[model samples]
Target: MIQILVIAILSLIAQLVLPWWSLAIVTFVVCFWRSSSALTAFVYSFLGIAIVWLGYSLWVYGQTDGVFIMRISQLVFKANNAVLPFVGTTILGGLAGGLAGLSGYFVRQVTGNQSMSHTA
Candidate 1:
């Protein structure tokens, strides 16, 4: 709940200020500190990144009337709808965030942190 919100907000801020991969690093650090289980970390991080990306995409779509994104969507994915590009972007961000969270959990496991539990 609160943790997920924190992850999302921090990751979004990091993404805005740093490189795109900073979202993954932010999620990794946060999940590691929180000691979340792999599944919990992945799911929460995915949700956070997906939500932020979708919200940002929607904001951009509204601001641009979908002209730029729609063109790119058509060029890359051959998508005809104005919304498909946003969906694709959200999915991509979610997948990357999920993997980063999983990697963080694995790092904790390999280091013998032993704090992550099924209850997480």
Candidate 2:
């Protein structure tokens, strides 16, 4: 829960000022600092970023009256539906966080610093 909260908040702030890739950095650092296992790191990171992205996309859709995401959806996915783009955005963001989180977890393991060793 803490990992999810930290990653989601940091990722939201990061996205506002930084490039999209900053989500990976936020998730990686959060998991490295708090994750208890590989699965926990990946799942929590995935959920955090996915939730943030989904919410942000919804906000943008509302603000732009769905024009922005709809166009993106058609251009990138050859679809006319907003749902595709929403799901795609969430999944992609989650994937970036999940992979970076796994990397962080493994690096922490290699360094033998299981600071939060309790199971999630």
> What is candidate 1's lDDT per residue for 1-120, written digit by digit as tens?
665787789988888889989989988877776745778889988998899888889888888988888897889888788777887899999999888877877888889876654343
Model 1 has an lDDT value of: 0.82
Which numbered prediction scores highest in TM-score against the true structure?
2
Which residue segments of model 1 deviate by more than 4 Å? 116-120
Q: What is candidate 2's CA lDDT for residue 35?
A: 87
lDDT of 1 at 101: 79
Model 1 residue 2 distance off true place after TM-score fit, in angstroms: 1.8
- Worst lDDT run of 10 residues, candidate 1, spans 111-120
TM-score computed on alpha carbons, candidate 1: 0.90
